[model samples]
Target: MNRYESMMNHLLVQFSNTKVLQAIFCAISDELQLLDDTFNNLKEKRWIDTGEGAQLDGIGEIVDRNRLINNAITINFFGFENQINTTGFNQARFREYSEPYLSSTSLSDEEYRLILWAKVNKNNSLCYMNDTIKSIQFIFKTDIAIVQDIYNAKFIVGIGRKLTKNEILFANALDLIVRPAGVSCQSMTHFDKDNVFGFYNQKFAKGFGQAPLSEIFSNNLIKKGYVV
Candidate 1:
């Protein structure tokens, strides 16, 4: 029922529905409706999951104050545009690089919200190794493991399945951004069930070329993101 109808029902039995009272109730109902709408908007638009347009932009600014990031590059579903190879012509011809690539397409509100929340969660991290893993996990919504090589000052992130073109881009950029200073990171995917390349022997002295020395699959290792 509308506010006016509810107001009329609340009156005593002796009171009549006069024209003057109806006019006053109609005015009051209009004002109350506007107030109710404003409050309802606040309830729906306050969070990232339900926010849209200006509300999503406001949330982005809160986490990414510097505005160093662009939605086009991060959230674009299409591949990079205007790509130029600095090396020989073969570079990036049959292969792709995770370098700070650009995108020409626009990102939808939902896509923007997803990436924004991932960055926000990463920014709020405590810089611990587990936090780093968790941040990456939040992005892909999958289980992954990180191998830390403290001696070499590097780490290897392993995912079980293959990542799509767009996912590879996001994963590469995220790894570089969240990595610690002076440390390197690499993303590896499509691992075997055994987690090793070949079988072992009693002597453990297999020949150098006995098994596959390099990665078994293509696009298994995505290099770190390039700043330039």
Candidate 2:
């Protein structure tokens, strides 16, 4: 028998008058199953939301051995628009859902939260911000074990609101006012002379890609705030 069944059998033998407890355990199991179903549905829908940006219009495979290593919620689903190389992802950090990769990395709490909200939603095409990716990402792995949602919770400085499971994906590219509604959100794609200059002159004056994002100068302008 499985672990749960074995445990229940042991409990029954240990305590003769424990029918109520067994019933309660059974009910708890049912509730947990329901929660599992709901979580799966939500995750699938979210993955679908990334369809517009993913390289493949349809994702299908037989072996499906390769894992999409991503920390950026949007990048996880959509991939990159112009570069198309996988921005917003750290490979090493993707070890949980993905097979281990030496080059992959993880994100800071604030960074992860911001990227999550910026993702496209099935209900609303608009992106915002949130902390839902970790739990949603882990739904597939939690069938046999209870996966804990571990994340450093933080706020979007733009809205000063705590993030929930559903929200938008923030794009550093959103600051590029030149691009139209959709393309502008692809920060890894566009180039805004003014924004780039500003980011360079003030934030990373040492030259671009010199320092870690957290080490950069601007908190409000770069990470949290919504700029035009």
Candidate 3:
């Protein structure tokens, strides 16, 4: 078996063996030393040799792994209530529910806007903005209607923002999926390279219309429309 499988099996044995548990408690300090040695040997040699090791590449990955491990350990070692009290830990509890929404390719213009708005707001609940409410109230707001075409169609979600150096670095590092409203090729030209416009223009023309960002946000475009 692999190191991971071995470790899991060892853990399961430790849990099931009352004699082993009693022995472990009696020799807790020595047991920890042995465990540490065993784990050290099991860890990837490359990770131990390299200074950087197998450290996660991004914060999101780190957070996600932490969530996974925390959940597993808690469920195995303690009961559900004993789960760590942390933002991402609690967030992980409902992760299955959030996964579909996070991975969703189909959403209406209003729904897309609401999702972006929720990200910007950094709130748990999806709520509509006054402007968004007004827009929905005035427009058809149908699932069939493309939001990008109906609206100003300037901003593109999931694009790197160029507002400031810190913002740029943060956006790049986080790989954020949200951008400012009304920010388009014309508006971004002053800061970004000309190629940015060309890339997005081609992307828009290929299947998406003038408002590529809006088209991407639209659930209909991704789910049923011709746009790939």
TM-scores for every predicted model: 0.61, 0.17, 0.18
- Full-model lDDT for every candidate: 0.54, 0.31, 0.30
Query: Evaluated with lDDT, which candidate comes out highest?
Result: 1
Q: Quick one: best TM-score, which candidate?
A: 1
Better of 1 and 2 by TM-score: 1
The regions of model 1 sitting more than 4 angstroms off are: 1-20, 65-102, 174-182, 190-228
lDDT of 3 by residue, 1-228 (tens): 443334335665547556665555545545665777677755643221221223321222323311111111111111134122213443444434233211112333333333233333332323324333233222222222111312465432222222332222222222223223443311111112112233434432223342223212222321221122
Off by over 4 Å in 2: 1-102, 120-123, 126-188, 195-228
Cα-based lDDT at residue 213, candidate 2: 27
State the local distance difference test value for candidate 3: 0.30
